[model samples]
Target: MLVRVLGSAAGGGFPQWNCNCPNCDGLRRGSIRATARTQSSIAVSANGVDWLLVNASPDVLTQLRAAPALQPARAIRDSGIAAVLLMDAQIDHVTGLLMLRERSTPLPLMATPEVLSDLSDGLPLTRVLSHYCGVAPLPLALDAPQAVPGLPGVTVLALPLPSKPPPYSPFRERPRRGDNIGLLLANPQTGRRLFYAPGLGEVSDAVLATMRGCDVVLVDGTFWTEDEMIRMGLSRKAAAEMGHLPQSGAGGMIAQLDRLPSGVRKVLIHINNTNPILRDDAPERAELTAHGIEVAFDGMEIAF
Candidate 1:
């Protein structure tokens, strides 16, 4: 199986247009050793031909242009993506479907019932796409592991996480079962598994078990500390209040990850613009290296 990191930053991307935070300002001024990144998303391929796009980020267009593997060179007006599987319905995660409206065929879109409802009703992305390049919705049932259509040998199981829905969702305050989720992608043939949870707010016992069993774990790295945005006066809410687990401190992502077996390859994704891990020489980045954790970057490829 091959996993490619299309974009690794959170919703705003690094050096976000409106943000001049230290990391963003430093990178923009060429004063920091860091790589600029786009929004969070990834592509998975079982045979390196047909690919499954995990999330269709707002930066999808630019992300695809940088990924030659996602460009089906077989024919004119073609795409390598066989299907799109979404974990949630945040604007940053699903708006790119509009960009794909030019496709000659309907899009194979998969998500939980709740997520599907949001796009079909409140968000209405699916409704808009219906006019052009229609969508074929595949309900991802969390009862058990099911084969991801189009990607042979690859199976996906939905693992529910504790998280709030997007503000536009009617049930934003009343969290539901499928509102947010992680995925367990398994190659039955190779017995190599990957656990992906890009927007996780907290790591539950089930989540930990899945990580322990998987060969690789790519989890939320949205904030370096719980009060990151609060300290910077960017937002009133702390990292936990916004449905993300900070990387440091007690009961944080890093502490939880340290408990995982050493053989499991651990990586952090969905990094926010203010996160200190973006700098090459920052202590935060060095700390991750010391703990054997990698910060996901655009164009990163992992094959197992």
Candidate 2:
């Protein structure tokens, strides 16, 4: 199994435009030991030729340009994308689907029923393009093992995650239907398994059990603390409120890390620019390394 880190930043990306915060300012001035990353996305390949994109960020073109291996020998219209596995219906995660519209055939996209319904109803990319190929929405049953279309010997298991509180409805108990997911990929051919959760707010007992015996686990690392955005005055929201929990402080990533076995390799992805750990020289970065966790960066590749 070959796992490629396409982009590691959260929604707006590192050094996001329009605002000149210290991290952005330092990044622009080359004073801080920070790295520039795009929105969260990843690609996995069975033979390194036929690749499966985990999520299509808006920067898909740029990511493809960076990794020339992703382009098919044939024209962009004939490229071999086995399928696109959408984790959720967030805008940043699905905007890149537009690029597929330029292709000759309709793209096969796998997702939960709720996510599929949201896109089919609210954001219809099929209607946007004149040559817009339709999206073949495949249903993904939570925790049930299934095979990815066109990719034999590989299996994908959807791990349903808890959603954020209902914003519009005060009486709602669970979050909106289309909001959260995690993925577990198993390749019997390679005898490897990978667990990923980019938008997870909390790691459940079921998820922890599923993560066991995997070769690699790429978990969410959106915020370093619950009060991060509050301290920065960026928003009135807390990390937990946005369907992501912090990586540090009490009941956070570090605490959860202690539960995993030592053999399982771990990495944190979808990190925000406000995260001090972005800097290689930062103490936070050192701490993660000490605990055997890698902070993902764009262009990083891990092969098993």
Candidate 3:
């Protein structure tokens, strides 16, 4: 299994255009020891030739351009990307489908029916893309390992996680089963596994069981604390309210990660701009390092 961390920041990339918070301002002014990042997205490959994108982030163009492996080679219009698997229907996660409108062939999109419906009805990317390069929807069922159509040797297992609907969804009464999910990519050939959950609301016993004995685990690092945005004056909603579990505190992701096998490589992705972990000199960075957790960066590669 080969995994590439294309973009590691949360919805608004680090140094978000409209805000000048401490971390953003510090990075912009070269005072903070942190690199600028785009929105979160990742690409996985089994044979290193055909790739599957986990999420088509709004910054997909920039992310793809940075990864030379994803570029076209022999054919003028050929793309290495075989398909896209969406975890949710958020604008930041799916808007990049528009940038792929110029593809020579229709792109294969895999997601839950709920996510596909949100795109078709509310955001209408599915309907609008029909006029351009069309999209073929591959329904993802929870806990079922399905082989990616074009990419062999790779199998993806999705597990539903507790999450809220995207704010733009017309049916935002409450989240149903398929609103969001975690992906477990396994390589049957090598027996290696990777677990990814960038929109985790809570860590259930099932989620922990899924992580057991996994080679690598990349999880949500959206906020450092429940009141991170509130303390930063960025938003009124707590981290849990926004469908993200904080990285710190007693009932946080760190505690859960600590319970994973020591051999499991733990990484943190989808970090928010307000999180102080972006700073290299922050004490939080050292704390995570001490716990053997890596903070993901753009263009990071992990092979198992």
Maximum-lDDT candidate: 1
lDDT of 2 at 167: 33
Off by over 4 Å in 3: none
Q: Model 1 compared with the native: what TM-score?
A: 0.98
Better of 1 and 2 by lDDT: 1
Candidate 2's residue-wise lDDT over 1-304, tens digit each? 7778999998888888764777878999999998899989999887777778888999888888888778777753556577898888777788899977776666888887767656665675535643577776788787689888887665888877887422332323545544568888877777788888988898788878877768888999999999988999998999998888788988798778768899989999999888888888999899998999999999999886
Error of 3 at 64 (Å): 0.8
- Candidates' C-alpha lDDT: 0.92, 0.81, 0.91
Any idea how many clashes model 3 has? Answer: 0
Is 2 or 3 the stronger prediction by TM-score?
A: 3
Error of 1 at 37 (Å): 0.4
Q: How many angstroms is residue 167 displaced in model 2 relative to the true structure, after the best TM-score fit?
A: 8.1
Q: Determine which window of 10 residues in candidate 1 has minimal summed lDDT.
A: 142-151
lDDT of 1: 0.92
Tens-place lDDT per residue, model 1, 1-304, is 9999999999989989999999999999999999999999999998888899999999999999999888878987888899999999999899998999998989999999999999988899999999999999999998589887888877889988888889999999898999888988887778899988999998888788889998999999999999999999999999999999998999999899999998999999999999999999999999999999999999999876
Ranking of predictions according to lDDT: 1, 3, 2
